[model samples]
Target: MCRWLAYLGEPLRPSTIVLDANNSIVAQSLDSSLGAETVNGDGFGFGWYPTDAPAGTEPALFHSTEPAWNDQNLRELTRAILSPLFFTHVRAAAAPPIQQTNCHPFRYENWMFMHNGAIGGWHKVKRDLTLAIDPSLYPNVLGTTDSEVLFHLALTLGLADDPVAAVGRAIRTVESVGHEHDVQFPWQGTIAVSDGQRVWAFRYSSQGRTRSLFHSADVPTLREMYPDAERLRLFGDEAHLVVSEPLSEMPGVWVEVPESTAAILEPGGYRHEPFLAD
Candidate 1:
């Protein structure tokens, strides 16, 4: 339903991928070839962990109801800030109202979460799903989007204690509740989450037909392959990215994240594991 991207590794200006990539997240906001909607102009958000911030600090957030391409403030801020990790999403309102709080990259403490799919029959599932969130976290549910609810549910189920397991538990809970309501495939989308130091990206849908998600190859390997590419040469070995769509057409630069899987990004490297509802 939308497009998003995350970056980890070297400290770089957010615009490097959010605005300057060949098919940048800003470009995808207007002309996404793979997203369910071609133009996701309803709203957008940016969350980044400042390079100079103390460890475990929450990311700073910037959101707007304006389209990414039309927001001069976005350009100004992205160009000015340098971050070790960040998230940016351009939204296409599904069943939710067009408001700034409904944007992606929702934050909770040190973690930031974003999604690019809907929970099928959300109106039917919303109440039950929302009631599952931890009472303390319930107040943080400032938005009405299913994506935001999913983040809270995961937190309630233990996202902070163990992200992968908690996400799996949350999805299972969603599926179980959806099935009870006669909705066959309750979960449908990809999710990206991070805690400043590492990121976790997932590709899953009840029907096995999910949106696009890809992560960049190791910087050193990609650098050797495209020695002349300035973008490739500019990054250090620890740089890594996970995006809703390929940022460029460069072969071997990006690898599609496997279906039904979660890919983890860290300064050391990347890892993939099957993502199941149960």
Candidate 2:
């Protein structure tokens, strides 16, 4: 299992969430209270779209095999950059070896992706799933983790045209391939994807149970609820976050994404839609 977060809305420093929050992503990497594994020390990755970059510019990436809390460079970089949308992931290796290529927030052109779950029976279904990726897109598959493969699989299945549909199809493919190998619950995870503008987050599994996933309450709502809290003053009304777990214990500040749902965050705000995996 892993822990990750996606942010959209106002332009702000990535460090505000990745490093500075009460239970920041970096803190989660070291001691996650809600993650399946408390220590996600395999590696970490951060991807962000520059605040004022030209349209279609791909998000910048920084990956390290070192644990997030132990990486000095990660500290320096996150503190230096500001982005309107960004992704940060802290990983805990299940079966794959820890390496930079295996880190999350994998990128393709203007799109970025990260995941916080696994494809059950990865070793049994790895070959079939890898071969199923479109031949043209297969060339871009750079890591051995199921996370990166799933990202390319989503791309091959048409993520660019319709991300929710593409991801649902990708999970179905994984489930079908897994069942062929006698793996009953083949998919388990929460996923986040972005095209440098909007963000799409999904929480689902082949089985009924899925990992924890939540999004921040609307900024205006938070402001009204915690009017005297100084931290609420840092964000614009449009600011939003989709994370594997709450970044803070503040009441009414995070909303749990319902099971089998896709949460989409765009310019106006965010909305939830049923995610059909079949």
- Model 2 C-alpha lDDT per residue in residues 1-278, reported as the tens digit of each score: 89999999889988888889999999999999989999999999999999977768899899999999999999898888878999999999998899889998999999999999999999999999999999998889888999999999999999999999999999999999999999999999999999998999999998979999999989998888888999888888899999999999998999999999999999999999999744
Question: Candidate 2: worst 10 consecutive residues by lDDT?
Answer: 269-278
Off by over 4 Å in 1: none
TM-score of 2: 0.98
- TM-scores for the candidates: 0.98, 0.98
Name the runs in model 2 displaced over 4 angstroms.
none
Q: After superposition, how far is residue 196 of candidate 1 from its true place, in Å?
A: 1.2
lDDT (C-alpha) at residue 237 in model 1: 89
Tell me the tens digit of each residue's lDDT in model 1 across 156-261. 9888888998998888899999999999989999999988888999999999989999999998898788778887766778999999999999999899998899
